[model samples]
Target: MLGSAILERRLELEVSQEKLAEMASVHRNYVGKVERGEQNLTIETLVRFAVTFKCKPSELLAEAGL
Candidate 1:
């Protein structure tokens, strides 16, 4: 659910996985895995994504209906 929200935000922002990874300071492959819901994420990673997306982590979670 969070992964899907992340993907949606990425698409809405017109960024590729590689770009989002760079912005979030994660590996491109990791971003792909995340979008596919194939990996677990740390809270730190979630914060990083929120920073990269210019939103709050809670907002992201809310968007994901978590």
Candidate 2:
């Protein structure tokens, strides 16, 4: 799922939720919610996450097995 991929990629990059959020211009709590699968993010937010993670959106989708 998307949550799992976010967790895996974040950990793989040794990035904290706060750091990711800062990079994505979102709240740390928002990042946490996304990672916990409690948030249904907008496309803009998803793109921000992809940019912050330095990966393509399709790559993220693939990693999430979507």
Candidate 3:
């Protein structure tokens, strides 16, 4: 569910997974895994993604309806 929210935001921003990885300072493959719900994210990683999307971590969770 969280991964889906991230994927939706990434697509909405027209950003590629690779680009998001670069922006978030994560590996491209990690980003893929995240989007596929194959990986768990730490608070730091969650913050990185939220920063990349110009949102708050809570906002991401909210977007996921969590």
User: What TM-score do all the candidates reach, one by one?
Assistant: 0.95, 0.90, 0.94
The top-ranked prediction according to lDDT is: 1
Best by TM-score: 1
- Clashes in candidate 3: how many? 0
1-66 per-residue lDDT for model 1 (tens digits): 989999999999999999999999998799999999998999999999999889999999999899
Q: Look at candidate 1 and give me any clashing residue pairs.
A: none
lDDT score, residue 55, model 2? 91
lDDT of 2 at 62: 93
- lDDT (CA) for every model shown? 0.94, 0.86, 0.92
Question: Ten consecutive residues with minimal summed lDDT in candidate 3?
Answer: 28-37
Off by over 4 Å in 2: none
Worst 10 residues of 2 by lDDT: 40-49
Model with the higher TM-score, candidate 1 or 2: 1
Better of 2 and 3 by TM-score: 3
Which of candidates 1 and 2 is the stronger one according to lDDT? 1
Encode model 2's per-residue lDDT on 1-66: one tens digit a residue: 798898888898898999888989998798889989999888788888898789988888899888
Residue 16 CA displacement from its true place in model 2, Å: 1.2
